[model samples]
Target chain A: MTDTLLEIDNLSVDYETGRGDLQALRDITFNVNKGEIVGIVGESGCGKSTLISSILRLTAPNTRFREGEIRFKGQDLLQVSERHMRDLRGADISIVFQDPMQTHNPVLTIGQQMLDIQHRSKQSKADKRAHATKMLGAVGIPDPEARLKQYPHEFSGGMRQRIAIAMALMSEPDLLIADEPTTALDATLEVQIIERLQELQREFHCAILFISHHLGVIAELCDRVVVMYAGAVVESGDVREIFHDPKHPYTRRLIECDPGHLKERARVLPTIPGEVPDLANLPGGCIFRDRCDQALARCATEVPPLDQLKEGHHAACWLNHEEATS
Target chain B: MSLLNVVDLNTSYGAVNVLAGVSFSVEPGETYALVGESGSGKTTVIRAIAGLAPAQEGSVTFEGQEIRGAPEKVMRPLRKDMAMMFQDPVGSLSPRLTIRSLITEPYRIQGMKDRDLDTEAKRLLEMVNLPTHFADRYPYQLSGGQARRVGVARALALEPKLILADEPTAGLDVSVQGELLNLLNDLRERLGLAMVIITHNLSVVRHVADRMGILYLGRLVEEGTTETIFNEPRHPYTRCLLSANPEPDPDARLDRIALKGEPPSLLMRPSGCEFRERCPFSKEICTQTPEWEVNGGHGLRCLAPLS
Candidate 1:
């Protein structure tokens, strides 16, 4: 088996706007190895969602694929036909969205929904129910057997999210993409969900692409962390290494701004001045230049490439490039 | 006298009893954080204080004067001294109204036409670190952070002595959230204004709060200084909530406590302790309303002793 499970190379996508095409994902390149948990961290409008959609070919009608290849299990997913993609979606690749309520059918019983999705499994109806109950129990849902009869409204928000996770894993897909699954949950529930996800990952051995803006969740669950700013990946490295010694200025600012790690009652939290740049009228050179604290004169004219800072660590910044050249 | 004191505040919506004998007080120039999960009645406590949600039983004394069950005319004057920032900025600000009009609406409501509203509006915008040009734009033209800043500006129109902000940083980016939090902290220090911040995030509590009260099933389960709550929590729920908050530092080892599920609905709320169903350390005594164990400034309502 190949070590890499999913590979996204130079993938660029744009959305059709009134004036012209607005670039959402620009030359984004990354890899998820077999059974590895990769985290994508970025602010809103940073193209994290676009990147996820690109993997499943679920981009909007206005979305235009400008460049790059998305290879899943050595086969280019972008080149696959619609029929083939459909088979691959839930069977080989599954996703858990941020809002579980939207994903679930409010009127249907949990068993009915679970059984409907398992038609492709070719298992007996009774067998499917057994598997569903087991998966739900694995996700820390109590009374899984009795819960199968309950409607979506019967469960609480956190429990609904857990049921969603259970449904996502019922197929035992090779790759799982969770887009801010715990963002809606409380802090305590967030911890429970992340820990449960970690435990499930170990048991299932599925490659996970976990996307979140919460740094603490990323730090706790991810083996590798990818930091995105604007529409591009600003930095990527091991979770601990990146958290301890962030290479990119944007990554540094993102980490420093989090109040989760503050040891004392902070008098004033350090803030990044200015607003996120308009994606339609993006600045030249680095996308993060306008809000970046360490932008140089050359940053206005030259776009920085993802330069290697260390083994398995890379940062896309002019400062890093200059340091390497010097 | 305390700036705001809520004693045995009990509120209910028709058949559902939301808050059951909730009590807390905020001193002058203090930042009090009320935190809880969804359906814990954190927002209800704030709404109760603002007179939006009237308490069925209890007394809310502001500056040593009883405001609960007060007449509309009596409450009208007090509105000028207290302002509230809603959780959803987009919903809080009217889409048709320009930023300037929104900020000055409070002054216009109080029938103060003599004041220089135009200048006051500009100063309010600047105080929230929003650009002067944004004053001309409608609420829809602004982003989430910008709209929140406008909400803060609107909340400060009457120069309120006590500010009640409900999740001021919700749905904002990391940097923007930090900036808004710092702005609130700075404003509190500059104006010596007391605040009651209602939120679900413990991180925000750690940053700006002086004291914090944890609510469960509309009851304040624990209350103490932020330092004491984080370092040495006596309540099982408080300890679980603190440990459940994932520390950003990867090196820190966390011992997480797994609760059964979310708080039961208000309709199906357990008799004694609202948290009895979900508390891992719950015992038979938890079925009865636990007595408040007070020590120094820290206090918790629980049957189980801290391990």
Candidate 2:
């Protein structure tokens, strides 16, 4: 039997806006297995960030978890105390944000910040410093000892991002939430970061919930993919299956829209012909029906349940559901 | 004659030399792309060409007229034949202005008071496939894609022969980015406008650019037709960049030529090849600078080019 690291079940989230309550995430469900990289792919306003925030129990003041549970190690994280959550944060889970320029304290040296993250550990100062140096070296930083003494601003953009990843993995957490960690880097540097992450993940034996809008990066790194649209999970399957044979119309269109998939130079690239619906006043059907090309008439009145099409593959679309049922 | 020709363009900010003798030429109705990593002076090349950033030395000829060091009075009339689209979608637009005033502000700036702005605004919006009613909305009311369309509309207000676009498809969804690319391609063909696009996205360069130049440390490492460069890249840096770009297909080969270390700082550039530090094919001969060699239509500055 496969070991499940984290299970998010039927989670729903809403934001209190001036006009009305904005439903950011609706009936979201996914699971990360031990030592597996799962990617969450979606466009802006599709609640990718909101899903990350909800898992860390770090929602904004004007937000509320409408329903569902985030179970980690068989215990519901939503039912945990603030103190318990705080203890579990760095020790059990950690995050690397998009912009490394803002990830660290400007005044603090890299060595100081690295040691500070390991404050929960009872190890001696010398041991922690040694660990920090090794971690920096693992991320391919040159002269780890001298580099640790320097400030974050002294590092280049690629180096800063590498250092950020080093700091996040210092505790050797079970799950690492990389929220567009390589998005800010250049193409060459992005490749380096992805390779380093792959190496580091294998060494640390930690699961990764990689979230990004770039389909190429997702395809490169993720083993399984969870495609989100309009604050809902439209498709979740093996990376190969999702890219090769996408069942949901939204997933198919998304893959087709990527410029990397274009074999020849065409005058007009295919595009979805509509905008994302307003979250405050959602339509009474599939969240993606407005932009979905293969949307059926039934899709306008009822939301299709996530149906199992094949082993370890699921898609939420009326067309897929009919195909599976038939 | 070429539509625009920039020969040995050199731009420097203080002691740091940003663009070091970069040169390229664009024919009328041709689309050329400047591709590079950040700090590689892709934007600065266009800025230098537009005279927004002063060039230390170079010859920029537009329509057979010398514009390199032309005075403001002489350059003022040239502005009507050239337009620029800034990188940011919403940030580039004036926040207080309505869509109507924003797109037609070019006419006002040029002191062309004889034309009716409302009709011009409607025409520009229709050209960009946006509803004419959008002219009444403010910049804040539009989405990223819509704001980009407005930027395009503003750039096309003067009906320029040449357009300089910087990261036109950035900060949009895949579908939205495709829409913008299609719009740009359609407009370029319909207007027969020559364009110089600056972006790091190789996919975008492949889609729209007829020819492309790969820049490293403010110098063109390689220049050739986009099809040739993608198929048979000569420079190690160009090959690395092409291989590094993550292809969306899962079945595509993942044999990435992982570049080592970060790009060296401009303040203390490495001797000889600037890309040698990260290049996997660096040899002893790479210590000395390679000549910019051109054969047929392809050119590259490399001591040991890929066969």
Candidate 3:
């Protein structure tokens, strides 16, 4: 059996704004193995979040699909009906957002929120309660019996994050997408939460599509990585290769951007020195041409295809780093 | 002499106690960072020291003056000697004002209506490594980083003896974070100003702060020289926080300290150590308020190295 759990092929999304139709993602492709942790790294507004929402068909109004497909287990997800997508959400695929406040319902108790997620697919109310309690236990939450009865406000931010994680796992979904899970959390709590998440992913053998801007998180958790910029995949490789041997100019800039990484280099890393291009009026050439350090005359007119640098390592930068060698 | 001294301080918001018996000090040229998570009372300590949140108990001495409950007249003069930078740049800056006007607001407060506020504002903007032309731009037009520089320029308008920065670089990018940290350190060295930086980022302590204090809820848990705390921190909570930070080096894997339970609420504050509820090394006696052990001028609040 193919170990690949999810594959996103040339997926793109557009939204109508005051500026008109904005293509947020372009020709993005990646895959995740059944039990592997795959990270999507990008700057803000790089279409990382929009990419996840498209898979769930959860994109808000005025957001239209431009092209491409999302396949989970060789079945086309983009073609799935809205009712089918709803059924698959809590059962086969799940997602956790950056904001705990948004993920949780203030009016409902944590048990109610979690139990309710799976009740439509499940039978027996008391049986659902037992599963919720077991899930709370699995997430390393304290006082599972009592906590299930209390409202979301009664819990601390860290506790609420645990509840959100437990809620996502309640259905035993094969794939879990967590978008910047630790962004707003305290450093200590963020650590605890990531640890619990990795442990659960292992226990369930669940594939995780981990999205974060922090390379530190990717190094610690992800098995592989896909680097995004200006609504395109700039680089994709194993976590080690992407971090240590990045090929794209954007990839190098992102790695060298970290204070810890810059400590070893002699000169300070001058960040890419410009904002991400407006997707609505993208350059005819490579999207990163405006900010690329080694842009040549060809780079200003020719869009670089995703060229292979090594086995399973790909970069879209026009610079032939491989040609410089053997 | 220590530039600022806060002893047995307590401050509240309406009916809720924000800071309880918080005490710390900053030497004339040192940067003392108060490190903690949100709602851990880091900002409250800054507020209490600045007199924005008037302390209901204890004393705050700036340059040996016991000026806890000074009247508006007395405090207004002190404002020239102390300045503050808030966390959110967009909200902190007056939305309608241009960057030039925002930077010179402090000068206007000090009765400089006749002086060349525009020229002085340009100088302040240039000092923070911002372009001279940036002064003409509105706060809304500036990016997150540019707005922060404007904020810093405004904070420096008074030429204060001390600067209190609350999460100065919280929302900024990684590259921008380094520039701001270096800017704060450079400003401190060049101007010989005392600084108290309040932030949740522990990495800042190593680069900018001379001394560091870890706050849990409203109580200060661990404190010491930056080298001491980062190398041999005795508190479990401190260890957990440091480990949780994404390691700069990709090769090093952090064995995160597992804090299984939730941190206790401030309303029902713990009887002893505020961290005892979630600490990995909590003992029976940790249920009692521990004394501050001052050794070699390093302080820690714990019944640690115990019997």
Candidate 4:
């Protein structure tokens, strides 16, 4: 019996904009195993947020999608009723966003806001408060009881983010989706958050879908990684394998573009020239061909499929396909 | 002599002090990066130097001219030789103005009405790698990178010798950030422009800055060349900061020397050493302020033995 916790197959979504229909996500297929951490890495406008929204069924009003199946624990989430979905959200699956202050209500006290999340629970008020305190302490928040009375404005940015994380795990969710949770944090605070998250993930035994544009954070936290480019999953594999030996051109460029990877400062850091393609008016075939240095003549005419490069490693690129067949 | 010198700088907002006894200098053609976490007073240090934020008890000299608390008449003509690039590129640019006028507005302020504004605007646009067609477009029409480049072009409109760029690479993607840093570096080399760049990103400092100062809770705790700072950081906070920066490679062995807690609040700062509460090497003497220990021009404010 496979222990797949969440399975996303051929997920495609488009947003209706004034320019036209923007193909935000294209034929994305991946799965997260039970208690495993998966990271999605991409630049801006690469459909990372759209993919998360699709999983939560929280896409924008003008979003159009029909060719995908999002299954959580062998149950199709798309087919679930709205009421059932609402129950499953905080209890089964929870998410933490980039900005915790924006996610929280400024007018309410921290304690009141956390208790509000537990309205569906059958536990008494006292038990819920104790549970909130415990979860807050679990995230290394000091003096959780005293902090409950304080409003969001009273806490620092890092502390507010910790509160957000604690609230996300209040219901003991089986899966936590953190979208750039540490992006807004300072370097020292980022390390603190990552350490606390790793500790809590083990204590709760939950799978995590970590989404970020920072390759460094993803490399340190995620067990497996998925590289996104122009609304497609260009590469997916174990973190170690993908970092040591990235097969796709786009994934390689993304890694090379990181300043930390450089041993010494160069006159000019190598960059992946050209902006991400316009989704509403994408060119024929592969999306990355325009910026890819090793793009072959056939790359502009044929769409590459996600082919297996090694055990548990996959990349969608014509170069990888040709190398595999040769 | 240094192109810009800041000494014993202290700044405050009402009751709370933002910068305390901070000091640094920028040589001609050199990039001095002031690095710290948010609220650590990195921005305040540059703002104090630029005269936007008043220095409570210190001196800021540009080309050996005191301007920290100088009157507007004395500071106005001096401002023409200094330019500031803001953090938020979109918010900094005027939404109603065209790119052409935005670049030339500085010249208009300098009372150079005889200059051909359109040609100069196009030249500035091309210098920042923006297309000539963008000169006619409004601020809302450009991408984030384009907007930032436009910001850079506008900053260069005055052709200032010294540029104070506040988080120039903030809110930019990695690839775009690399390109922007390269442009800044190239301009510095080609034009010998001295820059005082305030940013929290250590990677950017490592790539572009010749020298750096690490700030913690409004104090300049460490100052040294970039190579020495990254290779052998003396202060405990500097060591922890470098270690905490997540390296991109998965296999890079990072020493897990994380600080115990978040920075202490400014309202109730620690009595003596501002970082004493969070420093791993805090001891009995840490209850009192430690003198700046200097050796070979590299300095640190901690009493701990160098590792």
Candidate 5:
């Protein structure tokens, strides 16, 4: 049986904005299984970042968790004390952000920052340095020993991202949250980073909670995919199923609209009409109904529950309902 | 004759050489894409063409007029016919300026006092499919896609014959990117405008660009029709780039060619072929710079080209 590494159940978050209560995440539910790479794909304002922040317990000051439980290793992270959360952050979970340039401390040497991450470890200083060097080398950095002494500025964008990945995986955390880690890099560099992450994941045997807006990267890297739209989980399934046979209209449109997926060059690429509804003043019915082409009349008044369409595949849409389809 | 011709263009910033003998041309209604990594000088090529970055050497002829080193007086009038859409959607626009002023500012800058700015602003917004009410909104108030629409509207304000767009779909979501691409494509067709698009996105290049040039160390490694280049790439760098693009299809074959290391710094470019350091097919001859060779409308600058 597959082991679940992390689980989020009925998670809802709201930001107390001047305009109104901005519902950032609404009943978000998903889990990262042991050693499995699961990607959370969504556009901006889809609450992907908010979800990441919530998991790290680094939400904004005006944030309120409406209702949810973030369970990790049989412990509810939401119920954990700040001291306990700090201990679990690096030791059990690690994150690699989008911009590596901003991620690193300019004044600190790479070696120093990497060593600082191991503060929880009782390992000797020499052992820590050795581990850091080895981790750097594992991520394809040349001369890791000498490189550790250098500053982040000395490295190129690709190299800095590699260093960032190395630092994140140094602790060998059970779950690695990569928030658009390759988005800032070029296509060639993106490919290199993806391959490196795949290799590192294999070596460390860590589950990856990969988050990105790029459908191509998610398709290439993740085994399963969770498609988010306007602060809600629209669909979740195997990567093949999600891309090949998407059930939700949003997921289908998102996949079809991806330029990378187009087989032939067309002058007018298909586009999903309408903007994402305002989070502060959401529509009465389904969040995505306004934009969904095949939206039904029932979608105007009632919210669709996430239903099991197939084994391990779930989609939240009125069209997926038995009676609605009939 | 081509609408815009850039021959042997060379641009340097202080001590560092960015664009080294780059050359290309765009037809009156064609779209030409410049593809490269971050430091490959794709943006710099367009910047030099637009006279924003003065090129130290080479010629840029627009509509039979030499404009490489043209003074502002000479270039100002030409700006009406050739507009630029910057990379950043919101950041490119002034935060304080209303969307109406932002898009219509071009007309004011050109000193065209005859036109009513309000009507023109509404017309521009309508063209970009943005609502008329959005004219009063600030750059910060608009979404990424909306901000991009404003950028397009601003570029189209003067009824330019040619447009230079940099990374048009860089920051948008998949669906939004498609919408922007569709809008751009529709505008290009409707106005019969030529375009020079600079971006690292291969998919965007494939969808929008009629012809494309692959830049390595500020030099064009390959130049040809998008169809020909995508189907039969001669340069090893081109092949590597295409292979590196992750296909959205999960079942697609993953025969990725991982380059050895990052691109060499511009301050100290590798001798001979600049791409040789990372190239998998580097030979003894690669130590000497390969001459740019063209065959059957396809051009390449590599001694050890893929057969």
Candidate 6:
């Protein structure tokens, strides 16, 4: 899409092990439009984490990207220098990690963390407290003035998450990536935080890359979704279309698997026969061939291209798309 | 007869009262939900009933016998009648012990005689839909769903009349969560067990709980049937609780009620109506404790109850 905020082409990541080179992600391609929430969803160990890490260059020395282009806001992130990337990390692009308990410094006060974010954006330490309070209040932290003095341990799980979100937004990045930010919270608070985050996203006019294992969450926050499996993009489409009439077998299984999503499917839940295939040593041809109920002989020997079905929607399956053309 | 009856339950931590003037009853095959946010003291009431923590006031009657603060030995027999599942599966199940040994720990502690611990453990595992060979593996060897199954097996080992599950499906993926919830519902029906599920999930209560109770700070603000709570929440706190939860489906848009400010500490709780400070519809009587009102069997703790 010409209006795309991000266009990842042939992205691949590798993890070096004693046994051999572990292929964590293989030739993944996807895009997120401006102001659209695009979800990257997969079960744990399906390389969801690796994909996020690669985007931020947070991968350890043991991991390496073989080939890909990460074009964000018309700039190549992979080719950017450390100094340039550091400036972009919080100011131009930001991330909210899964666990605030670990992401937040336990001993430091919420004020200190907020100040740190402001400091990164070239604000004075003395003037950061007020800015921090304003940011915290914006995130819906009640009595942000008094709360700034309290340490992370003193805050409840939900409150800590709010503070963490405040930190992510302090710099007001254009692209905000949240990976399972509500996983550790109670359901009551989980819903509140997500709602608040959605409001904030709209108010800030920023694109969100929401990552989670639950398709239910993607159904909630994402405008578009990119289904990942065994280090490949299985399907990509508008959230409503993909959810209502999923074509790919993996996408169909995922929609049928979620109890909450079954409101639409409205039948007996169909679980995928086996667990996510091991990414390190993948078989030739389509990675989903072994598990697909409709797998043909050609699917086992030749890799299927991510073919277009309609405007801004694609699926990598050997299905007839001419009939589905809109 | 009601399997469990708690009346005017007033529990405390040191001098701080956490549960005040609470009353509820669980029928032989009913599921009761204790729903609330953090610091709402839902867990405290369960802990008090389990005797992990003591209730400073009120009575807990099991099988029509009241035991306010009995000695551990006097309460020993009742322990067999109740079992609790913790939120953290790893912490609840011993990392050092195999799944087989974990399930039998309750029986071992009570010093039961002529019990085939291994065989019973394996059967319990199967009951929870765990693989038979998983009995040999420790907690670390299992996946999140497997560990949850082990926890369920351990909780079911003694065939307790009542089960207190604290956030049973927290930290699990969606598919696994559905399986675990369905499994629990199936078990409850087959065993005719009474379950008091403590969670903040409104959707969870909708599917599993027959009745609902809403707690705020340290008080039971509302109590009624699931349909009553969802359809006509009388208390402002309960309404806010429901409205706060965003529907996972994007097609549905919910105008959430923003509950600003932290919950007042129990050490020095607000004068009256713990939720008054953040309540959207607080009235003059909100400053004073509202009298309980019953309409169509639904009781509410709000000055201006929803009609």
Chain A fold similarity by TM-score, each prediction: 0.97, 0.98, 0.94, 0.98, 0.97, 0.93
lDDT of 3: 0.81
**Candidate 2 lDDT, tens digit per residue, A182-292?**
877778788888888999999999999999989999999999999999899999999999999999898899998998888688778888888889999999988888887
The window of 10 residues in a row where model 5 chain B has the poorest summed lDDT is: B254-263
User: DockQ rank, highest first?
Assistant: 5, 2, 4, 1, 3, 6
Computed on C-alphas against the true complex, the DockQ of each candidate is 0.75, 0.79, 0.40, 0.77, 0.82, 0.31
Per-residue lDDT of A1-326 in model 4, one digit per residue for the tens?
A: 37999999998888999999999999999999989999999998888999898888897899998589899998888889999898888899999999876989999999999999999889999999999888888888899999899999988888889899999998889899999998887887888888888998999889999999888999999999999998999999999988999999988998898887886977898898987889999898789999999989888999988998888899999888967667
lDDT by residue (B125-151, candidate 2, tens digit) is: 999889999999999999888999999
Worst 10 residues of 6 chain B by lDDT: B244-253
Tens digit of per-residue lDDT, candidate 6, span B139-202:
9988877788888888888888889888887767656676788788778878888899987766
lDDT string for model 3 (B142-240, tens) is 778778888888888888899999989876776677677767777877898888998776655666778889887776778888888878887787787
lDDT of each: 0.89, 0.91, 0.81, 0.88, 0.92, 0.80
Error of 3 at A227 (Å): 1.2
> For model 1, what is the error of residue B249's alpha carbon versus the real structure, in angstroms, after optimal superposition?
1.7
- Model 6 ranges off by over 4 Å: A1-3, A16-23, A64-66, A73-87, A142-146, A213-217, A249-253, A256-274, A280-304, A319-326, B75-77
**Cα-based lDDT at residue A105, candidate 2:** 91
Query: Which candidate achieves the best DockQ against the true structure?
Result: 5
Off by over 4 Å in 3: A15-23, A60-62, A260-272, A289-297, A321-326, B12-18, B94-101, B116-143, B248-250, B267-278, B282-289
lDDT of 3 by residue, A22-47 (tens): 88988888888898889998887788
- Which residue runs does candidate 5 get wrong by more than 4 Å? A323-326
**TM-score ranking, high to low:** 5, 4, 2, 1, 6, 3
> What is the fnat value (0 to 1) for candidate 2?
0.83
TM-score, B chain, candidate 1? Answer: 0.96
Best by lDDT: 5
